[model samples]
Target: MSLPAPETPLYNHPLPQLERWLMALGCQQDRGDRHCWLLHQGDWDAELSLDTEELVICYFPHQPQRKVVRSFKYSLSRQDVEAAVLEGP
Candidate 1:
């Protein structure tokens, strides 16, 4: 009998999966860094970074007054991260 491979956790999804997940939400990789990405919709834009322990996101890049920064643990589900990131501050 063949054994099934263990399932990967959401936070542990491969880089390609991560890229696809972000792209599906209209986000694109930053030209300068593969770990960095940007998403734009209407007048709002967000920058995201995939770090070792967390996913860091900044909403409203230039305007300090309206900007919001959030970090999510890698243990969280992909849907949780998406909801938090896509929901504007």
Candidate 2:
């Protein structure tokens, strides 16, 4: 399905469109958990979870043994979340 404009709030998109957007960003859905997605770049890995009211992201090894976690409310514009997430931790 086609998605809304990038400036539109995420809450305005349908679930499948959101999933597609994530997939377009090179994220793979967790096989065991439909609500979770995973992404790996050359230098880092991240897990993104679709929560009840927000999208949560955890980046591995923000430090030697720690993961950096961040959350974005669904009310934010799709472009804003995309920029923040693509920026990495």
Candidate 3:
């Protein structure tokens, strides 16, 4: 029987590679905080945060009541994290 490889953490990704992936998805880094990023498409806007243990995403900054907050483990695939970020609220 074969075993699957262990999952890799998102934080394990090099900063440059992570930045490139975000750029490819039309997300820009927040000037105030390198750990933060902003993405806008049409009327939708979201903020992404790279915390020590989690990737936090907040969607629809204008509507605090309607904003969606999602947290993903740092130990997740880049593709998985990308999907969550791009999915929006």
lDDT of candidates 1 onward, in order: 0.77, 0.93, 0.76
What TM-score, to 2 decimals, does candidate 2 have? 0.93
The TM-scores of all predictions, comma-separated, are 0.80, 0.93, 0.77
Quick one: ranking by lDDT, best first?
2, 1, 3
Q: Name every residue pair that clashes in candidate 2.
A: none
Tens-place lDDT digits, model 3, residues 1-89: 22123245576777676667677788899998999989996657988887878888888855455888999997788777777777778
Clashes in candidate 3: how many?
Answer: 0
Better of 1 and 3 by TM-score: 1
* lDDT accuracy of residue 86 in candidate 1: 77
Which window of ten consecutive residues has the lowest lDDT sum in model 2?
59-68
User: Tell me, what's the RMSD of every candidate?
Assistant: 5.3, 1.4, 5.8
Which candidate number would show the highest lDDT if scored against the true structure?
2
In candidate 1, position 61 carries an lDDT of: 51
**Candidate with better lDDT, 1 vs 2:** 2
Q: Is candidate 2 or candidate 3 better by TM-score?
A: 2
TM-score of 1: 0.80
Candidate 1: minimum summed lDDT over ten consecutive residues — where? 1-10
Q: Please list all clashing residue pairs in model 3, or write none if there are none.
A: none
